[model samples]
Target: MHTDRVYVVTGGTRGIGAAIAQGLRDDGARVCVLARQPDPAEGVAVDLADPSSVPAAFERVLDRWGRIDGLVNNAGISKVGPSLDYDLADFARILDVNVTSLFACSQAAAKAMAAQGGGSIVSIASMTSFTGQPERAAYIASKHAVLGLTRALANDWGPHGIRVNAVSPGYIRTDLTTDLIARGVLDVDAIEGRMPLRRFGQPSDVVGAVKFLLSAEAGYTTGQALVVDGGWTVNGYFK
Candidate 1:
């Protein structure tokens, strides 16, 4: 359904970003995977943490595809530590890659999409976008900013036919989290018990929401954050 549509998926080298890229490609979109370590056959290698390099990386996408039909701001980094010990440099880098670059990439893609009539942008936010998690100050802050950015862009670019939206995935079983689980840093059973679905989500679970938002089917949707969690946000504890 997305045949010939060119999409730029940041941090598409692995995990959720890779899943999104593969899903889009499977459905026929020409997917460009942008990362610090990119696959030559996929797309350019650019460090999103370095904001200065963002535009040119995007430009490379345009150079190859001629135009951008969609963008998935899926690349991000997270540092887990107490707020007191949260290194300033780590915080800044997280914001640079997660929030700042997301905006820059979206802006670049929006311009191209606008010039070509219209396009869709789906950013990967987190369940943290809405709720606070322990020792994730920077990540939570960046995600909140991402949702805000999504809304702002939707408002700013709606007239140009650009739809800006986000996907908030709950504790998905990614390589990162899998490692955490293996190290006993996270309790899989405990997490699953808290979820209404009684299980953790998979990267593929979030991909469908993103694809829908980017497709013509969600033509009327904009400035919305679709939560792909298993009822984590909606679960409230009893007194």
Candidate 2:
């Protein structure tokens, strides 16, 4: 059903974003990667921190494809520090990129989708959207807002045939996590022991969830947060 559909994925140069873009492409959809450093061909270089760039990027996609069938708001940044010590500037920047940009892109996509009659929007939220982590107040706050924004957008755009939802990924094995492991800061075994699946997820894991939300299979789904975290949030006491 996604064949020939045009989908835009932000921060899709690598990691989970890249996986989502590839999954859509593999499903026969035309995927555009929007990021500060986008690849050539299907990539559109955009600065999500700058509000002006958001609409321009979406316009580029529409100019090329004429319609926006789906949007994956996957661009985000995280900061680690005690809340009391967190710089105000850093906090604002995080909110700008993670929250503001997400809303702006969703707004632009919604307009295009409304014009075309319908579309889907999925955001890549973090497990922190549900549970808090130490020294990540800004990231957690932004992700929590992501869920709220998803719900609000759904309420406003559902009548227009637009679906808005979010996917909360838990402890995905990516470059950031690998770097933590290399620095001896991340205990992979301990983390796996706590997770019911006893393993970290891959980018493809998130990709599947995003693609499902964007496809017709989830036409009835909206204003929901799909947690793809290996049952991390449900288990209060780890075995």
Candidate 3:
């Protein structure tokens, strides 16, 4: 059980965001999830790009729950293409959500956490940050920026009893990945051959990491990026 603590998860309607929210709820924590097309199931209606929307969204959670204990910055935008081919507007749009919005959310979360004496903020990063993935220039850049934000915040907030960190998933099976599969752009099953685990990751696999990172058990940890790639990034060959 989460002892009545609450968590706010962005992009919680589907994919990894929903999974993280569900995982925390299963552990008895209350959840508030923000995203576009506000789903009744999620209980939040904040647009990540609208920084002003974040505070009011957090306020709603506090109004209903009284306190915020954890935040998961699981929402982001990505554009894949040669960096030079990127339209100036499209490139900035990616940064708008993936970096700027997340940066704002983390700040809001920290403000609440500071008021409560301590808390955790978790961002979903990507393996593209560590290795070059062709045609995903904007995405890779944003993730690298997220990692940097995590580290900087960790150093500044750890002393204040707050932890900032990220979870970088390898190739995980989801609607996003499914589309790639259907397009034959990524072999959903074949790529598993390259991962040591011999399979794509499940939402639960990444959720487990979130649970641990936010739990009291990880009190001493912060500013670290946890890679949950099923061994996909550890090697280029052999699953």
RMSD to native for every prediction?
Answer: 1.1, 1.1, 1.7
C-alpha TM-scores of all predictions: 0.97, 0.97, 0.94
lDDT of 1: 0.92
**Which TM-score value belongs to model 3?**
0.94
lDDT of each residue in 1-239, candidate 1, tens digit only: 79988999999989999999999999998988889888898899988888889889888888888999999999998988999988999999999999998888998899899999999999999888998989999999999999999999999999999999999999999999999999999999888888899899998899999999999999999999999999999998622
Clashing pairs in 3: 81-135, 195-239, 196-239
Q: Which ranges of candidate 2 are over 4 A from the true structure?
A: none
Model 2, span 25-138: residue lDDT tens: 888989889899887798778898887688888888888778888999999998889988999999999999999999999999999999989999999898889998899988
* True-structure RMSD for candidate 2: 1.1
> By the lDDT metric, which is better: model 2 or model 3?
2
On the 0 to 100 scale, the lDDT of residue 31 in model 3 is 89
Error of 2 at 221 (Å): 0.4
Query: What's the lDDT for residue 87 in model 2?
Result: 99
Candidate 2 overall lDDT versus native: 0.91
lDDT of 3 by residue, 1-239 (tens): 47688898888889999889889989889888888865666577777776767777777777877887998999988777777778888877888888888988888889889998999999999987688888888888899999999999999988779999899999887898889888999976678877888888888989999998999888889999999998877886553
